[model samples]
Target: MTGSPVTTENVDPLAGVRAPGDPACDVYLTGTVFLDIIFTGLDSAPVRGTESWARGMGSSPGGVANMATALARLGLRTSLAAAFGDDKYGEYCWETLERGEGIDLSLSRTVPGWHSPVTVSMAYEGERTMVSHGHEAPVSEALPGPPPARSCVASLRAGAPQEWIAAAARAGSRVFADTGWDDTGAWDLAALPDLAHCEAFLPNAAEAMRYTRTDNPRAAARALTEIVPLAVVTMGAEGAYAADGRTGETAEVPAILVEALDTTGAGDVFVAGFVTGTLAGWPLGDRLALAGLTAALSVQEFGGSLSAPGWDEVAAWWRRVRDLTPADGRLAASLDRYGFLSGLLPEPAHPWPRRRAVPTLGFRALP
Candidate 1:
């Protein structure tokens, strides 16, 4: 209702890249949506069995919905593509978003006999673990594909349908997709190859190693080049690396020096920040550092969007680091790579549909 666009596709993430260009939507998420029910003190030292502990009640939209909502708050013309039921939660979701300024909801499809998906989050001390459940519904909402938006960043997890993918590519937009696999015990990594046509393919280093079956991050990143010229692999703490033809490079983004309270959706924050910098014409390493900083701030709070940092906040933090010149190797390196760089190529080769499998989230050592 805030004017943010919305789309819903039945994405079987394991389907290996659903087809390029999904009507040029900004982002597509295919995953189990959850409510993110959390207990503030759950992670704290627990008393014997179930002792009476103090906590707060919170019910908010989560997953890709949560990510898009957060980005909208940062003043972006973001569109969300997902599914929900024609139930009470669905109404609340719509109402809550409507009240929030800076988002559009025209793309939200209300499916009959379906319940809005949710995740119960138990946030006690510093960690949040999610027990997620998805509502089963028919894919009957025949909404038309969206035309190319400003910049498309699609995260294929578990909710979108296959047809939408083809529609997205047809829109002719700057596309980037993160990996999301719906391995409900059925191992299929179809999204990997399908995202090949995107401008950037960002998968965690661990997932790339396992899914691509490669040991080196550079090789894995470059390998993704065949699918899309610029492929990136993010290494938590170590930094993020990218490869594209004779332009292969890696930069270490320094992690924020904050005691992380919760890491749920930290990855999503990183993606949003990175993409924001990219669309703003910032250098890659700077973009990565900005992403890491945003993610670091996210873990210091609870919930998904509730913990996100606005642009001003991020800029302030970056200025502090720059002025202080703290000796953090990773962040310093990222700045060096991205700082004062100009007149770079405007675009990398478009990604061909992926030909390999999308790996599950995990970790991989760098070469």
Candidate 2:
């Protein structure tokens, strides 16, 4: 029997929408651009000085590529600003994201004689370890201009300069910021000023704890509220914590669990979903739930940027259980809660093409 028609009762009417003349793009992201070589299917970490083998290997643009592609897959008109080397690797990355994923890279440049950054990631037991090379220098401060949109995504790490944030704010753009994993544990307090300029500060639970000098994720999120007007701390598997400085409200959402194959870009996908919900003016709880589901779906496949689900996948999910009985329990309950799914549009005609040799993992080396 076929599933029943989906219902829209209790769904937020404004779950996803772009305001008229809001921005040139839905989300503008700026950060490092790297060619990612990902290897998977390892049962354990490599032994000291020993050779190890991997079952799967795929190459794709890493770093901000993950966020840019995810945003586009979610039907957001996305843009990226970064420096790329005038090398074959860079060309591959540019074409994959720009042509294959429909991302605007007009603000990104290709530097002559510079080799693009490359990262080799090894995935094992739901965790990943990456070794990278060729990051010679940061994208020059002059390279990235003011965000050309009303909403932008930024990284708080050293690589992402703060000048763009300042310029974007002056232009009345909303900035959403996230940070990188700190290997040194210094947890630089200086980054706080840059974060202050963001409309929302989203950091993982560990990063938030260290940055706020608190052990509890909720407490850390609360402390961040004192800085940015909105704060969200993502806790892998457990869920997410959020604090709204404007309404003096707080919320926690449970993670959506699924069989995870590779969690490479789950966080970035989560950010895309959260941004989608936020732009739609969904309630904080709805935003978190949507983000959690997006991340959950990403881990079900291989590759990083390529694994991101599009509107088609989301629509299929809704259709699968549209007619299921409430007695169907958790899945049914979640689908009902996300009744806003009814508003989702199908994948556009001539929506970016996918490379066949590797299927959905859009990786094409420059010939």
Candidate 3:
């Protein structure tokens, strides 16, 4: 809320190729949204029986909202389908997505008498511990079908198949999926039946290795391509490696070095970046670079959804890196790697509203 007047004038990454009759939305997704309360500036995790005080705190919509906000801020026309509780928290989340981020929530509905899901996250020593509480919304509240869009991002859970994924694929929406950790410890790929329709699968190094039974992340990425057309394995500090099954192309990009403050939803931000690049049809290496850069930026801030950077932030980061004097080999290499962004970034104008995590939700009325 502390920036220039919030404006929706963002550079459309896909402007040059857009044709008439194209889907109005660039991405479509559906999942639960949680009210995330984050506590930062902690030196270490709290001990039992001790009253701990965090130096900073912030609140924002989380869960699926994290990915939704990231996509919208990147100038993708994002549409979300999810259930909201008829409560103050729900109202705040709804308004933030629709008005603050310009996300289309027409497919979302509110359930009467239901309280919103909430998560309390404590970030310390570059990691986070979270405790969440909420009951599952009734299945009857699920979206009837996926809307036509250029692409859809989905979280694939083992043993639970989302029917809309196949329907969306059949309707010509490219599907990109990421899986949650299998608490059952099975890590069986067959459990994710919806993956058969996905155009790409993105997973962390451990998840990729466990699912493919490979000792190396790159090997896991290769093995994963047997199932999906594209496989991206995020190697954390090492960056990401991608394998395109159809074209037999492979690319690896190193992660950007940044002093991370909180990593609440950095993975979701990474996926949003990849989705933007994929829909815009960038090269595989450029897609991986953009994804890593966006995630690197998100960790420097607090909360999940609000910490997401808009095109302005991306442009600013590009300019900052390009201006460094006496550049070393590493800096020069980075400049060369990200040079593709020069043509895509919008010219600097009134910076897009750069939202940050604030301690309180209540603001005094302006005179």
Best-fitting candidate, scored by TM-score:
3
Cα RMSD, model 3: 3.5
Estimated TM-score per prediction? 0.72, 0.85, 0.95
lDDT of 2 by residue, 162-242 (tens): 777878877787889888887666786564567767899889998999988998999999998888999999998799989
What digit string (tens of lDDT, one per residue) describes model 1 on residues 157-178? 5434355555666656666678
Once superposed on the true structure, which residue ranges of model 1 sit more than 4 Å away at CA? 1-33, 44-58, 124-126, 157-161, 181-191, 319-367
Per the 3 Å backbone cut-off, how many clashing residue pairs does candidate 2 have?
A: 1
Alpha carbon lDDT at 17, candidate 1? 27
Point to the candidate with the largest lDDT: 3
The alpha-carbon lDDT assigned to residue 202 of candidate 3 equals: 98
Report the C-alpha displacement of residue 70, candidate 3, in angstroms. 0.4
Lowest lDDT block of 10, candidate 2 = 348-357
Ten-residue segment with the worst summed lDDT in candidate 3? 346-355
lDDT of 3 by residue, 1-367 (tens): 6755433355888877699999998999999999999999887899999978899899999999999999999999999999998899999899888998899999999988888999999999988999999999977776657888999999999999989999999999999999889999999999999999999999999999999999999999999999999999999999999999999999999999888889988999999999999998899999999999899889888989968877888887777677766554455567789999888775544343244678765477799
**Structure candidate 3, residue pairs in collision:** none
What clash count goes with each model?
A: 57, 1, 0
